[model samples]
Target: MKFDKAAGENTLFDNAEFVGRPTHRIDGPLKVTGTAPYAYERHDVVEGQLYGYPLGSAISHGLIVSMDAEAARNAPGVRAVVTTLEIDPLEKGMNNVARLFGGAEVQHYHQAIAVVVADSFEQARAAASLIEVEYEKGDPADYDLGAAFERLQGSGEMDTDTGDVEAAFSSAAALLDEMYHTPSQSHMAMEPHASIVDWSDGDQMTVWTSNQMINWNHGSLATTFGLDEDKIRVESPYIGGGFGGKLWLRADAVLAALGSRAAGAPVKLALPRPFIMNNTTHRSETVQRIRLAAGEDGKLTGIWHEAASHALPDGRGEDATAQTPFFYASDSIRAKHHIVTMSLPESADMRAPGEAAGLMALEVAMDEMAEKLGMDPVEFRKVNDTQVNPSNPEQEFSDRNFVECLDRGAEAFRWTDRNTAPGATRDGQWLVGHGVAGAYRGALVLPSGSRALLEGGKLVIETDMTDIGTGSYTILAQTAAETMGLTLDDVEMRMGNSAYPVSSGSGGQFGAASSSAGVYAACMALRERIAEQLGVEEAEFRDGRVIAGDTDRALSELEGQIDAVDSIEWGDFQSEYQMATFGAHFVEVGVHAGTGETRVRRMLAVCDSGRILNPITARSQVIGGMTMAVGAALSEDMALDSGRGMFANHDLAGYEVAVHADIPEQEVIFIDTLDPVASPLKAKGVGELGVCGVAAAVANAVYNATGVRVREYPVTLDKLIGGLPAIG
Candidate 1:
């Protein structure tokens, strides 16, 4: 059935036995025991598979004058060397801005220029170092953010203006205008971008890669290689993690396929850690300036969120203000984004693209505005909450419980006992304080299809959807079990193969809701087929038994196997209602008075993202998001070398993510809500929403502890040391 209207009271969902239970990941044991086969580890996948190592350009911005691979080609065990200089320039994918294998003109530092195939990984690595290349610097690299800011231009499509923001600000009783900066960040997934390619007689190629979107990467590979879509296939059943890094086709797959063709054998390639940083995409650096106007009663009158971020010459800027227009209620609001063209590495989505960065600025500004009005941050947010779109009052939100989220989070975090005055609460040499921030991420659904087959009392579901450690296998199992009245073990799940039906393919935090909805559609068809065989109009299956009004039989007693395939398409509800996920974050922090060190003592998140499909997996997602946001608040930043135009700290040791010791006890509470407009499942995504306003919450806590307002990200000790009260 097409989901064109509100799913008014789904009796199946209400009667579900496992849909909302805490089901563990189905692939957990395989991953925990180190039996899960990653792309590079599949050495036995093809006969005589070769190893390929990519060589990146040494210079950042330059023209490749000449390349000499004779010595490397003649070296030991070298099967073939494919250089960009000799190969035709490949077409850039639709989602990509920079060409993965640009021959002469290099767009950024560490761009792949060649790949060497050899008998072993060591031989390929050693031979790669022998290839000599000559480069001539083209022009001064545009690495300065300030310089790029001067050239910022409005993205005409993303710009939104409702009323006179200036007039509202001028008449407001309370106002604040501030500038904040967020530096470039890396995905830093546990597994690197790796691929293994095998080609057949007809030039039909199969790529076993670690990617998030299967169909999207397949289309990209076909486009890049100038092959028909049917000739290329992509498979990625299990992903260590993506965090939006593996959404598009990267060089690993392309280079592996190209090297395999050159060497006349299957090839495998895994990008080194350094190349993962400079060669692949990273989140762009942003300079945001937010202006908030509020009344004496703490109600917002106007809000202006304007941000500028650096992207490549042909790259579209990050939509840093995408969440502002709908997050809070304001009479006059203007949200604009400016794209600054620079020579930096291409920018793409990471976690919650617009909302993550936008809230880092907007939420903190909300706290500041509240302080200006002498009100509590939670109270300020509750007062400004809107059930309708702030920019377009005619559009109503399908469901919004932002105030409840804030109130619940405050109560769970024990806000009433906290000291509002800075440095009033202390333990020995540490000063303690609390902070709160609101979270918002829009809900989206895509056309997704699935196939379900029943044989010997067991059902198998197949789709191209991927599980990037977000528990796709388990949630889908629960969905199928709940729909077909079977145990989790009775459902066999198969996915991440191009042969399966196309799915949404796990990105933008929409994987769980969209993919499961597709599964539901397929299972419904199977139920109908089963009922027809029993000669009944309606049937209900419970615990391996099918029951119609008068007829009942065990599933195994059925005469033949049943199979069905179906897809869920977008409906009119999406056009009529504004769908979004809402949550609130509360944090308690302690600051060392002497050394100016800050530590998060506790964190609690209250979310209202509709129908927690699997409590364990959903909670895990929120906890992971909270941990990542802690890194963004305290230590994550990729340093830029303007002179060399490369990321200075390209390795994991230099790039600091939050360690286990850095994290505190975290609590996640899901408000029992079912948004009928989201999908047949009545569930929305909570992954990105988990990180939405987390950083601002941590930053606000720091301000309450040390009385310092740090506008930049990774609120380091240096920023707080200057304002710390003199040590006793």
Candidate 2:
């Protein structure tokens, strides 16, 4: 089923029994009861499984001089040892910027160099520590983005340009130019990158891993291992957490496979917490410059956004200017991005990716521009809202309610009650103020496939879609149940297996929309098959019965089980419509007058991202994003040891995330609407949109509380203490 035309009055729209309802997670019981088998805990699947521990390179960049694994091979209970020096560099995965294993040359710190296999995890870890390695360090790596930006200023690529931005800025009534910095961030998922691989079969291998994309990893493993795609089977039914860190095949999976092949037994490997920061992918730090020019009426005339971020030579940089071109109405708009090769670590997607860091600078600049114009921040954003893409005026937004989000959010947050004068409203030693920022994230969809089986009066749906704690199982069940006119209790969903039909695989916030559409398509196929079996041209499924004119037959009365397989492919609808999610973030904070400490009192996010599939799950995603935003605003920062080209604070103790005490009240409001151009499900993505502008809103609130505008991220107290108002 190709979604070529705009969806109109479909079953999901007219007779939705579960699609748009607030359904609880179908897999909640398994998770809460600790019965769900995570990758590292699935010890009952295979017998005689050995443990594997990986050894990482000490230097960030260098060529391996010598490696002696003799000590490790002779260590207690050691079964097999595989070192990078013995094998040539393996092929890199499609989604991986840095090589997972092999090769003598190190691309970054903590690059996997060897694997030690033993009878137990402790034995494997002990054996891995005995391996000796020598390296000839290369020239000092380029780890400073500021210096790289200075060298590549004139060579930067201009991604987008509209009218003359310079001339418009020169004549604008209000102009604001500033720079902001966001530090590199770790995913810090609850479960580490873990995998268990079994290669006992002659040429067939099976891997149970905590990966987000099953199809991608399956293909990657086949390519990297020089085996046929059909020979590999990847299963990841439950993932503890993955903020884009487990999107690709990491070293844990690769090492486990290699260890299993060498030891002639199934091998399990789990990366340490420190290795997770440097070995796996992380959100790249960005240096962004935003220049906004507006008229006296609070209408934006020119908007220029340029950013510099570091990545591996073969990797793409953080595109911090992704949303600038289409976010607001501007006659003159320009966006430029510069990528600098660095040897620190692999920089890749995390949550909202580009917009998460970009909006931290752009939205804060919006607040500064509003201040220059003496206009309210929410009002300023409302006046510049555009129904069409600013970069391409021919394309109009499918469904955008940015102004409504702003108005509704401002009203709910009591924006009018905010202290207009900075540092004037004091509650004891704390100064209170409010802040607002607009959110934007593109709604993306991918071709996804699913299989449906109707057996013993129960509907079963199968896809490779991963849950990642985002309620993929629940929402997918809801989609199939609604399409088949069955209750949620009568539907069973099986996912995260490569044998299942390929799906969108839960990234870029497109998982729920695309995967659910695929299930819907498969259900439709089943409906057609049921109609054909009943000798009818068409049939309506209701109350678990197929109705054809005057004849009605219960699905349970069918002679045998019926099955259907189908996929949802997209056409040129995206070209005709600008599908994007929009929202507004409002925050209230109190700043300590003497110590410059800040604490958030409350936060509200008003989102306009098409139809909500499951309100319960949708709220969980939004609040999770909000909690991350608090960390990005106040605590989360992966301290880089630039001199040594490594992340100094690689462990969780050094790198802080938001805790219960750090988070205050959070509210999420979804604007009720359907996006026909987005998908057959009439839904867009809200996960990324929930995070886009939240950090900026927190920064703006802090600035309002204490007239000290923080240009750098993680707005720590040290940066604000010096500029804060003098103690009373």
Candidate 3:
């Protein structure tokens, strides 16, 4: 049962001193001591900044008959009131999936129609309520995903089929077909999208905002405001959390810029907690059908996953079936995408996107097949291990450790002690169960670059990748320090600024790998520069300096000679091999005997991503993802009021999240491995790994515990009350 290989077995990154070592976040002191300035927290940047408050629509789907801003403008401290009809089109944001409000048409409830600028935040918010608008309300379809989703002409490179799934299932010896629904989920990132915008000296603009992708905004905001990209600069070094929400332009960022331009002064805007749910983006709910065809031996012969999600009228599908085609090998496989147009809030990327929701159904199906075949779920998946993408048989995995991940995880959890029977293991009033699901995430690489400055014998790393509390600063520094053989204190790292070199921009779990690779490239450039400074006839490295035939001086001594090249830049690494992160998530849970609430008892994850730049921070990313999946699987769902087309449970008090009582002790392991294909440092993304399969494992465990299969999300106790067997 012990599947952990020796320390040197398969690891690519764990062998290095700095790679596996546990290091505290380099920005920890500044953040904990309140020195790190967030977007709305910076005071010296703009002295006369006004607060902007957005007025959301009351009607979900409607044409505005009239908007009266008289009362709003008359309110205390209200300076300027801009409504959708009043604001003319500067332009649209290129990367924005949602059409931001303007021109008198309500797409969804709480769509921003007006921004009330006032001297204080509270004053602006109070005045926002005074703006009245007449609407010719139209019928809204919110809870009706089944009907609205059929309109999708379904276009994308996403759909494919190897062999006919209908034919395979019809002839298969065993089959499991089921439907699963995941509800709309809010990112609920602690930092509720805030921004401060100020323009200066005729054409130049500077903004501070809470966002994970800085380069993206540089272009999107410039286009949205009809300005040159070079004139607009954004900076935000410390972000609370994004969970994939801050990857694109949110309302605060846009509204602040518009308000600032109109008021002829800086403006500050942060969506009210009540308005955050509807104003910004959230993950779309998915109704996925998973059909599995297996032989008598429990080996899957065919896998079919079809998912349809509701999106705002102008939006694209959530693409929830992205990972289904390649997850496991099968003779026949098909994955389909369907988008349904609706008048609901815009659906944007959440952590793990397609894979997270898809696995909630697929993993549970694998578990069900294990139940039907009377085989251990772990054993069942291993039996059908696939090395190549079933949909594209031509492309094989560069490295797939999922099989070993499950083997090692099962050994660590003592999974053999688990019984396949429902209502089997119990501790007095508590029912005990263990369930696990394999985790699969595609490796993705994005174009990124970083700038390095070697001055005063210190290495400075600069990239525009926003940290978002992900320890990006610490990891990038570690990578630089490793390459240069410098100590942590000797390396200074700066990030989250448009002025810095463009980065991959911190989403899709690609920030760590992509940004660090850029840093690695910069460091290599520095080594070459140092060699030139030392006048080294042949390439040579020595004690923070270079030597030309034993004639070397301290790197600091070359400061006077290196006027033309104090800082070096590097780019154009996109043509390299595809960089991707991979991992496995395992979960265990308990269902309350009478209440039916599912609680995660413990969790384990094994990641085989190449060299981890910072083990401590990477594991933190993994655990954070698991925490989110825990809520998504059990208690998190945005309640939609169909008649109004608005999220009813608007406040934090009503929306349940996983607290300390909900989270169990979690263990993570990294199979020491490096991919030369990735980059010189050879690392992979771990941000979204913990999110991938944690939910389905818990849901599958609840089934193993109580024998109830409730597919609609939030697995509330009421849904399980009637299904629980009579207790002793």
lDDT leader: 2
lDDT of 3: 0.77
Candidate ranking under TM-score, highest first, comes to: 2, 1, 3
**What are the lDDT scores of the predictions, listed in order?**
0.88, 0.90, 0.77
Q: The CA-based lDDT of model 1 is what?
A: 0.88
**Model 2 spans with C-alpha error above 4 angstroms:** 725-728
Q: Please list the residue runs of candidate 1 whose C-alpha ends up more than 4 Å from where it truly belongs after superposition.
A: 150-158, 200-202, 725-728
Clashing pairs in 1: none
RMSD in angstroms, candidate 1?
1.4
Model 3 per-residue lDDT tens digits across residues 1-728: 11112113323234454655789998999889998888888888878989999888888887888988899889999877888888664466855765575777777888878888899988898998888889998874556875544443334544877877778798888888887888988888877889998863467788899988998888888877778988999998889888877887777877787777677889989888867688778888888878899888887788877788878766764777877777777888878878877787888888888888888888888888888888888889899777766776666665667788888888888888885687788876778777888887766766677877878877787788789888988888877777665677878888899988888888887787777767766766777777766667654443565556767666666664231112222233322222345566667778889788677788988887876677789888888888888888889989988778888888777777777778869999888576655544556788887788888888888877888887888888888889875842
Displacement of residue 308 (Cα, Å) in model 1 is 0.7
Which residue segments of model 3 deviate by more than 4 Å?
A: 1-15, 148-158, 537-543, 561-580
Candidate 2 local lDDT, residue 638: 93
Give the Å error, residue 456, model 2.
Answer: 1.9
For 1-728, candidate 1 gives per-residue lDDT tens digits of 69988888777788788898988889999999998888788766678889999999887877899999998999899999999899778998768888899579887888999999999999999999999999998788666775555455334553789888889998999889898888888989999999999863457898999999998998998899888989888889889899999999999998999899888889999999999889998888888888898888888888888888877777766777989999999998888788777666778879999888888888999999988899988999999999999999999999899999998988888898887987778888898878888999998888888999988889999999999999999999899988988899899999998889999989897998899999999999999999887899778888988998878888877777799999888787588889999999999999999788989999999999999999999999999999999999999999998888889899999999987898869999999699989999999989899899999999999888878898899899998898886631
Write model 2 residue lDDT over 409-453, tens digit each, in one string: 988888888888777788898988788889999899989999999
Query: Lowest-lDDT window of 10 residues in candidate 2?
Result: 148-157
Which pairs clash in the backbone of model 3?
A: 10-672, 11-672, 11-673, 12-672, 12-673, 12-674, 443-580
